[model samples]
Target: MRQEKKSEKQEEKNKECLADLHTTDPRDDKERIKQTKGGLLEDSSNWILKHDDFRRWRNNDEARLL
Candidate 1:
């Protein structure tokens, strides 16, 4: 009874948290993809190049090294 109601509230809270986690800001996704794919490989590669850890490894670098 009371336990069931509490569980339901907890479930709703969890759902809201999950929804928040899943919702992507469009700009963030675009930046993520730009950083991911080697498409940022150019003289103007600001975002990807700025991320030191990400820039340290490429597809080939990962395969051959780490």
Candidate 2:
């Protein structure tokens, strides 16, 4: 039940993010660049690369292929 509530909140947040992207002004190139460099896109990718689970999985895969 708690997990479902968290999942619903995340889904709503994602929807709002997508809606905001569509509403952003196209003329604001500087704002777009700032967002691209410093926003969720970069943060999420960085998190994945640095995450412990990903690191362990990557190392295990590399060792397995040897």
Top model by TM-score, which number? 1
- Cα displacement (Å) at residue 35, model 1: 25
The runs of at least 3 residues in candidate 1 whose Cα sits more than 4 Å from the true structure, single-residue gaps closed, are: 25-66
Which digits, one per residue and each the tens of the lDDT, describe model 1 over residues 1-66? 999999999999999999988967899887989888845556675777678676566544656654
Q: Which ten residues in a row have the lowest lDDT in candidate 2?
A: 38-47
**Would you estimate the TM-scores of all the predictions?**
0.38, 0.35
| lDDT score of residue 55 within candidate 2 | 86
Measured by lDDT, the strongest candidate is 2
Tens-digit lDDT string for candidate 2 (28-54): 866787788874454656878888988
Q: CA lDDT of 39 in candidate 2? A: 43
Clashing pairs in 1: none
Score residue 11 of candidate 2 by CA lDDT: 100
